[model samples]
Target chain A: MAHILVVDDDEIMRALLSGMLRHVGHTVVESDNGQGGLEQMNAYPAELVITDIFMPEMDGLEFLITLLEKHPDSKVIAISGGYKAVNACLSLQMAKALGATDIIAKPFHTAAVIRQVAYALQSKTIAYRRRAER
Target chain B: MNASQSEQIQNTEEGYPDFAKLTEMREELGDHFLLVMQHFQSGMLARPQKIRQAFQNNNPEQLALEGHSFKSLCRQLGLSQMETLSVTLESMGRSGQLDGAAPLIERLLAYGLQAHCELQKYCLACGKPSSVQ
Candidate 1:
């Protein structure tokens, strides 16, 4: 079991994601937006962070950028739903280029969320080892 | 495509939520269903104000940002009209076009309140939350 952070402006979305994570035996932290997410990390860093791309007063992109700059070991997974409506991949693509460890689109199923978490957790070990080597 | 197709896609009167999605979440949440929905209600309540504030501030990016999050919320809940309006708002914000946004914003408010009222009916069905705020 790992500690994870979920950042989204919508409370329901945060509740749903956190609930899913908790049910699977992982401890979860919730934040309303990117700014709050950073604050939560400073208060008590988590093993992984799953953030949404669009938010007010410090969006996921700014959050990801700042997080990586401050904590080089941080593992992040970005999410979004706007791409589907806008019919574009630019946001997710930019998230990848900005260094999200992985990405998941919104309206994801429970199985898919769990699968992504498992994969991200696996990478945690690899990240730690690589850092230890350095 | 055609006007009929557009109308069909934009139809908002179908319902407040996609019952199938609600059921899936209900199965997953068990006792927490009411609480989860209540949380949605409160968040949705605050949405229109924020949208209007963004519009008043002439911040298309903010509108887009709100739409981005709102779209996901409605998508999961199956709030068709709210979801459709949110998409249009997001696109308008992206293009920085304010024309006709006034009416759409009002429509967003209407749909949001309508969904809230409808959701309350279901929350009552949950047989919990004596005082669902």
Candidate 2:
């Protein structure tokens, strides 16, 4: 029911996430990377953002840093595949410190994705700032 | 914050992928299952050249990126064997140690080809005709 932005370097991830969101009746906007995500947010500001951590031009951690700086109220979800045992928790912890509202590990189930989106929407204050409301 | 990764991690015990998970996804996604698989064929597997180049050139950064992307996509589709191989490749690349990576890359390629065939057949049997190459 809310406008959501899904950002990831993977085209399939963008397609999969946007498809899932659309199935649940949420309007979705997709971007290939964080820089593109920032531009999309500027053009079609969404209430929620789901992004991936490792990417070419701009990674998710950097994006979270930038996004939170620009729109501190925006809800952000960071997704990462994580290498073996070494950077799984570390990567996510970095994301949290950088201001991601939530994080999702790669290869997640459909229900899990839907649940996180719902929780972020209902419990947390939205990231999208209406000009009039702000 | 630990709750963010509450979902169970799915991987295969054997050398192949668990298609049952994908079957469930097919039911939920219906026609859009085609789109996901299509991306698997076209978008995901479209760059073996880059992967090989990274591995051969000892470009740890590129190798890690390739491994990260490949394993992530494979896990999503339940291709656990390939996911396992890719994860190893990613770890090695991240650590800047490609020692013994040759055999791993070869196995990943072999498994990847098998996975592609299985996915093609699966999609064709799913009521919609596929133009897989």
The CAPRI-style docking tier of model 2 reads acceptable
Q: Where is model 1 more than 4 Å wrong at Cα?
A: A83-88, A124-134, B1-15, B53-61
After the best TM-score superposition of candidate 2, give how far the Cα of residue B45 lies from its true spot, in angstroms: 3.4
What is the C-alpha local distance difference test score of each model?
0.77, 0.76
What local lDDT does model 1 show for residue B18?
68
Highest TM-score: give the candidate number: 2
| lDDT, candidate 1, B1-133, per-residue tens | 2345347545646437766777677666666566777777766676866777788899998887777778888887888777777777777787788677787778778777777776777777767652445
